[model samples]
Target chain A: MSERRTPDVLPGYEPLGAAVRTDDERWPTASPDGRRRLDGLRCHPSAPVWTHECGDLLTPEDHAALDAWTDGLATDPPAGDDGPPPAVLERLDRLLAVVPFYRRLGVDRWEQLPTISRADLARAVADFVPVDADLSRVVQGTSSGSTGSALVIPWHPLDIARDLPLLEHLLSRCGITWPRDPSRLGLLNVVHQEQAFTYASTMTWRDEQLMSRVNLHPSAWTDLDHRAAFLSEVNPQVVSGSALTLMDYVDLGLPVTPLAFVSGAVDLSPAARSYVESRSGTTVLDLYGLRETGPVAAAYGSREGHHLLPRTIHVEVVDDAGRSLADGSAGEIVVTSLENPYLPLLRYRTGDRGALTGAGRDRRIVGLEGRAAVRFVTGDGRTVQSVELTQRLQQHGVRAWAVRQRADGSVLARCLGGNHPALREAFDRLLQQPVEVEPVSGPVALGPGKPRRFASELGQ
Target chain B: MSDPLTDPLDHSVEGPDLQAMIGRLLAIPPDFLAGDVEAGPLVNDAVRLAGVRPAGDEAVRARGLGELALPERLALQVGAWMVAGPPLAPLLRTAPGEGRSYDGESVASALLSFAGLADAVPVARWTGEDPERHEEVVRALCRVLGLRPRGETHGVAEDRWVAVGSAARRAALRAAAEEQRKAEELARRLAEKRAQEAAAQYTHV
Candidate 1:
């Protein structure tokens, strides 16, 4: 390939180099010899190919309302006051009317009924799959199995259709304006194996978007060389992955920086999010959702609440009795998959808890109050979020910790890696109840693979 | 069988042949591309646009690229590769089944980045002058530029692709050290801030 190297290529460029620095910078590539023939190498930035063309799926008013909702703006004359508007409820009704599982239940209606749990779904899993669709074409996916059991849900293309535009809307929050010409879009997942899939398996998905998905597990590549080569080659404008995977790169000190970073699955703490954002020089948008549900909520920025995708699904924050809680009160999160007829889930309990803010199309989950076990009941029966308890301990430099609410309502705890030499007085005063604190020697017993900030005698 | 005339990757001969090659590469006759019949022109554009202006120690110095010592030029070159390489390489390296193309603005940005890196690499070397520090610099440069300096491609050729693997084994170690340094400082600050907030909240409670 180097047989006939252009001799004096250096000398020739010297004048051009001088012109670049000292005067009217003549970009040498402007010359005919340097003319770039980039037709195949580059795409013309035309209309987006990634679009589902589903914007019209919404009634014009609903479409405009959705646009406004995603843009973080209020629609004119607001879609609804306290309850959802007619269009929103109709969408949910239409989606549920076709649910294979609902029809099989031999029930006239499922909404406002006892919420479905993972155990219930697993027991009747077959009923959820749409009766009309061919089994071959449907895509089956498994959940994270974090809450004791995993739900394997089968989805048709229509199930995933709302996701593309909804994601397009969420990603926009990170200041990532897409339809980027000459850009490679890359996704990373850390599956704890060496390499589950080869690097850069699929290429560009559109004329404007070149896509690559890579597993960033230690076993995936031979070494850093392979990791660097593959990732830098697929240099993405926006790098989206789990919080753990993003932290792995940050801790490894990999130098590649993307225009934006998006993380989902696990909760990203402010401290960890700060480290990654500072290290990568980009903002991290925490997209909160479940495997059964696609893109249910997202925090546009680190400190913001998880905003609900009101157009795609209807969300209800219900108390223990299945009664809907008003805005500002935390309760179990129940969601209905508004678009999936193949395997529809209505008022499914997510095991997570948060409060809703705003009304109708403007609704958002201000913040997740952690899982049910994270609740700390005060002596006067006041429920305090475990994150608040940890935040107090954290201020005192408590690095690693696990706080458990005993059956008697007292608190037993493990604290490690901080300046909490005396914890009982500090904690008891905080909880307004007697507290037992023991500094854990090794890693704290936070429970399961992923730890809960707070544990309880009662389960979620 | 492709004719040598249409082999757009060829840079073997110069003068009118080079001009003809460039013309062939740049000129994709509209009718010829009626039904994706411009594979030659397509490959030509990719090769031409992605081609770097490789330089050597002297040429690099002239352009104020290699004028700075060892790792500085290497560092500059690496930053450029991060820019140019990501956009161009993925299209060629990982062409999807659907064969999606990238837009020109992204292509131009990528090419310019490669150009920056290409110009910087002429004198991108370690002179064994300060073996300990020079070794560290070389390895850091390799990681920075996303180049795995191998035994096969490591030299200071004028206007040619070069990847000097001066002490490649220790490159990862050096990069790791730098990375740890950045993380350690931030981790410390985050922990302290968390502790403060926790303490205050507890007191209020």
Candidate 2:
């Protein structure tokens, strides 16, 4: 076996064995101008040492398959209201044959199959994976979003690369052209949290353009002021982050501006979207998706609702009984996504509420209410994002929890399983007040519908 | 054991006759005969005795009835014989055309007619919890099997079967509890493995 060499640009970088490209096939180095930009980013007073490593890990065969898949998306007609298209049904049939979870259900009809929740995935994720899937190339990612459950999803590099085409399609729909600029960064993924996995990598699909995931928290940098300076120096073509992160970005008073902003992970309110767009002088595309289902829909600038993005996915609104409701009816949003070859989601309940309006290409999810963007104010008058609390609680190994901040600035927290006193101490330190941490039996005690992970009585 | 047909003390057989007695016994639900008995393995056992294997391996199918108590064993045997229908012919010790006095195929045919009637049995005396009620069903099965009751009188036989049935039911309950404990232990181990795999990666969203 040939030994792999670490590049000088990515400090403390470790390459994964699952990467399909050999050391010789990797990009030799960044361009001369790109190297200068990288130096400025690395030399920033507050830049954190890159801690984790990842790559596209796509092979030549995967590239060819992605091209064909994207081309098919462009040529295929919009899905009608009748039922699942033949292609989706065919995939479902194959899924039942290979996936143990679906085979045990023994249901041929798509509607008859029971809806699966995040808790189900948390319990036994291997059951959903196909028996014939290639485990050698699989990479794992955990999602402990606003939902109290932590699910580890096994992802294929090819599946993740497909997100590029979907984003390109969304960008094209808005008449935005993303030209390749070797000098400037291609994309900047921002996260405003106490701790996160920060990395810089070259986007092979975007012509080896530079991309990085940077945390905006003070601890991630040498100084707080460097956040704006580092962002200005990168000058990415497009920036992507959650609604809360973008709000933080706007509040930072940064001088740099990108062509567009992609807000996801949680719902983006109209007021927040308008503020981000006006402040940055760019359009804010509110994306609706979960880590489990890639990119599902996007709402353009000032649009009332989100339009469906992928042709392969079948989105629906279903009642509590797992029966599909009428188009205009409001219910939990369920999706049958064919994106991940390793995990074929059949009627996977997303635990978000929405209404499906119109059909085909004009289909839009109106009145979509996903994870609430909750911000808690500490006793010291400092504002704390719920994501920070999520990081702390997860670090304590709290599996499932819901936290609510009362109007009095006092907090009440409940968790399903974890070290209770440790969790209480963690909360008290974050909120800067004596917080009550109650131990609960199950997810239902948290609340009805979706477990409201974080709720605030301190109104927006 | 003496043949009930020749036994002078087997007066109960003369009153109801063999077919009527078998019909009555077949009419009782397996649960009514013995509390909390699983019929799946009993049916599988009967099928296996008739020379056909079920879906799973023989060891797995037999594990359900393995080491069962006396009342449970007797209940399963009677239940399996009742469910055997026409398949019980080949399982009979006497082969057809062997110059045997009794025609095994005719007896098997008689049992087949009463096969599915187990589900239609009424709750006349079988209270499911009372061993004395279960004893009545066992006495009827003894006559059908051509064996005399062990006791001198009907009341004596009923008393003995009740004591045995009661002990078996208690053992069955204990076994069920132990099986449940084992299942819970397995689930706990599976949950630990899942938690380990989830934390193995640094990727979080």
Candidate 3:
């Protein structure tokens, strides 16, 4: 465990490889202050947990100390600092100078780099991965995209380790203490609880917070009762999941109450949020971030827009042409991720559309719409996002669905799982008109990118 | 899961060479079929270009080139059932998509910002979620149709996909049993605690 010797290959830890490219050695190598922080790894005072495999992440004790140490160097700028911090800009400039992808793209300046789409990254992700990466440390995955179109961004091991603090800061902003109360569990409901995606561990990396990540995708549980029982049993003080997932769980009619529920991963519709909040009696905190960039923003309490996570990443709203847009103007959300030296993406085009309100720490993305929004129009001209409607159906346990407004202006709903009459009645009621529900063997019209939730051929 | 017995798309396309029949009927040119063979165009990209539409009869028409075999019809059914799999797997000739491994978390975070839930599903980059029931459903359809889809297609017909189906079922049974055992253990512990508390109260009295 000596500093001179390379760290052991921890369960999830990846050792840095020898320098390949001239600047490769520059990666994972840190400044004197940064190197001092790495000393926390040697101290193993955290309690032993049966399932925890990695002992490398900074402990909460280390977090408090390091946070205090880095406050002057790395704290957020004043509330009125309109642009990215000078330090962020300078580091990004240095990152651009080194990352192979940016270098190959000839991105001498941040603005010189072209904004990338999810489709663009999906196409060139392999090329974007750094050549000098320590292969063992690299882990890859696709985005949690309903359209099934998202980036497969690779991350350096250090970037993964660095995420620990960002998560803590984001959770703190949400008003919930992290390494949460030992008595109340921190339940994480993710997309898959399948065996392969099973993450059974205490928060050994931080404080040994009793945390569990369950797959909310239904298959993870034996039945709905099982899901409810699992939640009631865990009775997490902090329940974090996509807004839709939280809604579905709440709709299960469980008596479980948590201190707060953090919502992200999907559009948090007012209806869904209210449904959960009214029933569960907990605040819904919307965390705005992307995997390519770690958590960059989170709303405090029931705040309308998310406060920017400028500490971990810098966010800007720009028009389609990549021209930076003024505050309050809706445009594409562009992020300059401060993490991930393995495959640094500067000016990465997040396909979501939103507007930044306020400045510096107060900045928040408003009107943020991910995926091209298509609305299902009722005969009476009332329109709602089909994605929203589909989520509503999912709340009723219908998966794999699509709603289309035919050329003749007839609303048709198709699904593979449940053709529940109540679900149909709900859809019809939403449209304020009678609609046909067709039980099908396969999905309805699924166009590229996001699932074409609402398709209209009536020349809308 | 599309039932082999009920689908009107069920046709005469069959035999051990189910992949070939599907390839021929759909008039799937090599470029379109390139992804299925794990060759040609990048899988995710090629998969988007050609595939059966979800529209009922139109999808059937696109899937079945005029006349069809039971095996071919089953393949289409299998393809339809694979809406939950990689987008390209539905179009590629029963082969899995190769470029990326994104489970629910990665896509979920991007689809919506669940940064807390990010890396909740690991991105093994170049890996696709291979749920056993999907393979089991494929195997079940194949068995009922009595036409063996090609083995090396990589998309749907992996060499051990059928085995995966059985293994998944076994794992499911084991999981259910394990779940029951855990519940019993918990109940026993609770009961023991209750008894201990009662004895303690009696002793205090």
- Candidate that would win on lDDT: 2
Each prediction's DockQ? 0.01, 0.04, 0.01
Over the stretch A1-460, how does candidate 1's per-residue lDDT look in tens digits? 2122121121111211211121111111122221121222122232111101010111234334444544543232343435544545664544433333332222333342346656455554543443333443233444533322234455443343344345565566555765544545433323222212222211112221334334454333445466665565555666666665666566655556676677766666676688888887777777777767666777766446877654446677887766789888988887765455445666777767788887654568876745322457666654554534644564465555677888888888777656554456556554667687777674535543233356777441
Error of 3 at A299 (Å): 2.2
* lDDT of candidate 1 over B1-205, digit per residue (tens): 3221111222221111222222232232333222212222232344334443322334333344322322222333332332233332443243322333334333333323332221222222222233333433333323222232233122221012223233332343343344344334423432341211110000000
True contacts kept of 3: 0.00
Q: At residue A203, give the lDDT of candidate 1.
A: 18
Give the winner by TM-score. Answer: 2
Ranking by DockQ: 2, 3, 1
Q: RMSD in angstroms, all models?
A: 30.7, 15.3, 21.5
Taking the tens digit of each residue's C-alpha lDDT, what string does model 3 give over B1-205?
Answer: 5432222222222223443333332333323211122111122222233242222334323332222221122233223223223332332334323332333222211112211111111111101244443334333334333233544343344344334544534543353344345434433432331211110000000
Model 3 chain A lowest lDDT segment of ten: A10-19
What C-alpha lDDT, on a 0 to 100 scale, does residue B157 get in candidate 3? 47
lDDT by residue (tens digit), candidate 3, A86-192: 65677765664344334333235555455654544544453344444343334343354343332345544344444445555555665656555545554453332
Show model 2 residue runs off by greater than 4 Å: A1-46, A145-149, A394-400, A441-444, B1-205
Would you estimate the TM-scores of all the predictions? 0.44, 0.66, 0.48
For model 2, residues A1-460, the per-residue Cα lDDT tens digits are 3232221222112222223333223323334554455445545565665544445555667768878888877777776555676768878778865565554333456765667767557655665777666555555555665454456677667777776666677788888887778767788788876555576666666666777778776756766677777788778787888888888887887777788788888878878887898788888877887778767778995556888776577888888867888889999988778878766787778888999888778888898986777889877776778877776676666767788889899888888777778778777766776698888887877767566478888884
Model 1 CAPRI quality: incorrect
Point out where model 1 deviates above 4 Å. A1-81, A84-88, A91-101, A104-112, A134-136, A186-205, A369-460, B1-205
Scoring only chain A, what TM-score does candidate 3 earn?
A: 0.65
